[model samples]
Target: MLPFTYALRNLFRDPSRLAQTVGGAALVVLLMVSAAALNHGMTQVLSASGSPNNVIIMGAGSEESIERSEVHLEAEAAAATGIDNTATILGTPAVSGEITYQAPIRTESGKEEPALLRGVLPKALLVHTTVRLLEGTFPNSGEVMVGKLAHRKLGIPENEIAVGKTLYFGNVAHKISGTFSAPGTVLESEIWFDRNDLSTLTQRDTLSAIYARLDNPEDFDNAHVFTLLRNDLELSALREDDYYSKLESFYAPIKIMIWLTVSLVAAGAIFGGLNTLYAAFGSRTREMATLQSIGYTRKALLVSLLQESLLATMSGTLIALLIASLFLEGITVPFSVGTFTLTLSPSVLITGLTTGLLLGTLGALPPAIRTLAPKLNKALRS
Candidate 1:
């Protein structure tokens, strides 16, 4: 068997070609890692913040968004019985009925953005403990609460844009009051206001969703049935996890768009890396031939070439992962995980690493084999 040095030296024997191969693979890996991180960030938003015990009651036929649904008040009242007050320590129903809307908003810096706003009752906070006021107090009637995301996007300090000041959604200016951050879920991207205030401002007559906590985490279906059988409200009960799954399906197009972009971009890099490996192997044809010309077998040379490709691919993977870990540090996308920070978990890192490994193998093997074939003998004889 030849020394490992032999394989390493052959790869960089042509500096320019080596750069081309490694650099191409690096670009491909970088794209995939970043896209994967972003997609995971989104998936993590709901999965991380979602709870098995929590249930979201939305108007039937609302699909993934509550913005489209309008529930009747009496139906909502009837569904309240599903709550086990004994299960709620506070002697109140562990439920929150609220409204969610999408509004075009801008920062104090004059940058316009669109975000979803949730107008929820105080009980909603009790129901969803993941939500907490990280900075200021909760919004009161005629007042509003903004999330940390709104802080950045709106270019305002944490709930410090001068309380009593007004933010316009459409034509009405809702008074600024407090701020809150919900853990891991997409709620951080949301701004909240008093349901009563929102109703008065929009002149809306009904709530969009009713969220509740169950006595048993496993009773999601039981609670769901309790809500579903109500004769009054046109309610649809969904376990939070199941609800988000539907939401993910609803947003499948967006995820597909990201995947498509990554695929198209990565394809070029894959091809470039493949060519680099082929050329690198071709340049080493005589050396590989020399090895085989001596006591070394063709299989050993092939193994060496495979090792080189794998090493290069591994290096690119490490590089991409480093960038993802450091740069993607605290990216809070407009989604939620339970009441926690949407972090880059071990799973995401594993996925990126796996992707890198595949990139190395797929990009390097075929060309390496073709070059290390008996054709090396012909080249050496030349």
Candidate 2:
């Protein structure tokens, strides 16, 4: 068997080739890490956006989109009844009727971009525990409170919609009276206004949805039953967690697209690296034949080739980790509905490492086999 040191020393025989292998592996692993981070960031945002203890009631036919749902104001009161263990504050059940709209708004810089507009009563803050006022005050009539990541979602310069700035939506102008944040949740990219004001502005007499907090998440079954029994309200009840889970499913296509891109690029990298390996190892055929003549087995030579390949790929993996940390870690990516911070969590790191090892194993096999296929006399002559 070839000594471990034998393989280690061979890596430095051609420093330029060694560098190419390592650099290629690094670029491939970097793409893997970036793709994994994007998936993690989006999944985390969807999973964390909903609270288990909250329930949403929307019009029966519009379960997929809150903006399309419409319930008479009386539906809020109807849905609030018959649910046990409901959360309450100051003797009022933590319930809110809300409306949602998506429209293009002109920022202070006069750049127009689509923004999600949510109109909620004061009680929404109590029901949605993730939200909190970060500065100034809640919005009043003719005013709006921007979410912390609203500018990112709008693709505008940071602080361009800061407090006291005016933004034009449709024909009406609204003041940015405050900013709010809902950490680790999708609510951080919405603009909030008084529900009545938004309804009047948009000519909407019905609410898009109703939110309620329950004392125990288990009571969601009762809430669902209540919605089924009340044909009068024409509403359907769904647990907030279940709703967000559906959102994850809804974003499944985006995830597939990301994977498709990575797969296509990684395939190119693997084939490119394989060609390089063929050239590199093909040139060393005589040396490998000489080692075999010196009592080294074919398995030993194959293992040595794989070891060198893994070493280069692992070095590239390390470089990818550093780059992901420096650039992708904590970077905020905005989507149509919200923004999420790219995370370099342990899971993402593990994914990158696994991809690197797989590349090394697969990339080294063809060349290693080709090098050993020729008879000893033929290899020596070559």
Candidate 3:
């Protein structure tokens, strides 16, 4: 058997080949890591945005989009009174009748971009338990509260939307009174306004939806039954967690596109790396043949070659991980609905390490076999 040092020493024999192998592996592994992280972040944010103990009541026909739903103001009173097992804080019922709008708003720099807006009353806090006021106060008649990541969605610098700044909704300006956070949820990318203020500004007479929190998740059927019995209200009830799960399904095509793009690019890099390995191994045929003559088995030579390949690929994997930590971690990406932060979660790390191992083992097999294929005499002559 070839000593471990033999494979280690051979790597330094050609500086250019060593660099190519390592660089190619790094590029391929980095692309895979990026894809995994992006998809995981998007899914994670959506899943965390909903609570099992809450139920959403939207207009019957607009179940897919809350922004387009229109519910009569009277439905709020009906839901609070009719829904059984409703959760409460002190004596107030955990119900929030709100409006959701998407429109362009001008920043302090006069730059305009479309942003999500939610209109809510103080009771909104009861239904959305994840939200926390990080600074300042809740929006009042002439004020608005910004989410911690709203700037990313608005395509502006963080200072542009900081507290004390003003944002223009058409000709009227509203003070940025506060900033709030809903960690790992889509709510962090929205601008929240007082319910009455948004109603007058948007000229909306109807509520977009009503959110109600139940004492137990199993009580969901009671809420669903309430909607059925009050057919005159034209309302539909759905568990909040199920609503977000449906949104995740709606974005399936976008995730598929991301994977397709990564696979195409990685294929090109893999083939390029394979060609380099074939050339590097081809040139060492005579040396391998000499080792066989010295009583070293062909299987031993193959293992040594694989060891050399694994070392280079693993080094490249480390480099890729370092780069990801420095640049990709905590970076926010905005989509149509909200913004999500990239994270190197356990699943993403496992994906990257597995990709590196596959490339090192399977990617090296073809060239290693071809190099040792010829008879000893023929290989020596070459």
Candidate 4:
């Protein structure tokens, strides 16, 4: 077999070609990282938004969207019976009546955007234990509390959404009374107000959903059974975690579309890479023939060629990871409901590297095989 030095030196034999191949591989890897990061960010956000011990009872036919659901205020009163082993705070059952609305909000710059506005009774604080007030006090009538990511979702500057700032939602000017955070939860992208006040303003008397915390996470069956018995309310009960899992399915198509785009572009890159490999290996036909004549087997020569290709591609993979860390990681992607920060976590990094290695191996093999196909005499002569 030839010395490993031969394969290593061959990688840099043509500096310009090496750079081009590495750059192309880096681009393809970057595309892969982008797709994986996007999917990861979105799916993680949804999956993290729910708690296993929480239960949601929303109007039937509106399981996918709380804003479209309507549960009577009476449902909140019956929450304790609806869920077995309901959690309690200060001797009161942890239950909340909530109303959700998408309202047009005017930013400080006078630009208006739609923001998800959730109206909740005080008990919501106990039921949604993930939420914590970051500053100031909860909202009163004619006042509102903004979530940490609400400004980004609304396309407003951070200063404009701070406590004491005034934001116009519809014709009513609601003062920003506080800021709240529920890290890794969708609630961090909504505005909160008093339940009665929002109902008055939105002209909706019905609550959107009833939320309750249960002592045992497995008590969801009791909630479901309760919902079935209350035929008058036409409500459906779901475990909060299970409900959020459904959101992943709801966005399944978007994930598919992202990968579809990457597949198309990567296919072009793979073909271009294959052509490059063919030309590069084809140029070394006589050299490989000489090695074969020196008692080196075809398999050994193939390993040498692969080592060279992998070295270039792996370098590109490292470069792609660095680029992703600097630019793509933690990028905020806003959607209709909220925003999620793109993360280049370990799994995502591994995926990018795996793709690069596969590309290098597959791209080089066919051309390398074809180059070694000719008779030893003919290859040496060529």
Best model per TM-score: 3
lDDT of 2 by residue, 276-377 (tens): 899999999999999888988889999999998898889888998998999889889988778999989899999999989998898899999999989998
How much lDDT does each candidate structure score?
0.70, 0.89, 0.95, 0.89
Ranking by TM-score: 3, 4, 2, 1
Which consecutive 10 residues in model 3 have the weakest lDDT in total? Answer: 313-322
**Which lDDT tens digits does candidate 1 get at residues 1-382?**
6688877876677777766666666677777766766777676665755677788888877747678888776655565665443147457777778888776765444545566778877777877778887655688776677765665444455444445556776655667776566666667667788888777766899988877787777777666676567746667777877777776676678878988998998887887777767766777677777877678877787777777777777777777767766777675444322122334577767766777788776766787677677565596974
Give stretches of model 3 more than 4 Å off: none
* Steric clash count of candidate 1: 17
- Model 4 per-residue lDDT tens digits across residues 207-257: 999888888988778888888888988899988988889888989999999
| Count of steric clashes across candidates, in order | 17, 0, 0, 0
Candidate 2: segments with Cα more than 4 A from true spot: 1-5
lDDT of 3 at 307: 96
Model 1, runs deviating above 4 Å: 81-86, 106-110, 152-166, 220-229, 335-344, 375-377
The superposed Cα distance between candidate 1 and the true structure at residue 326, in angstroms, equals 3.0
State which candidate has the highest lDDT.
3
Task: Name the lDDT value of residue 57 in candidate 1.
Answer: 82
TM-score of 3: 0.99
| Candidate 4's TM-score | 0.96
What's every prediction's RMSD, in angstroms? Answer: 3.2, 1.6, 0.8, 1.5
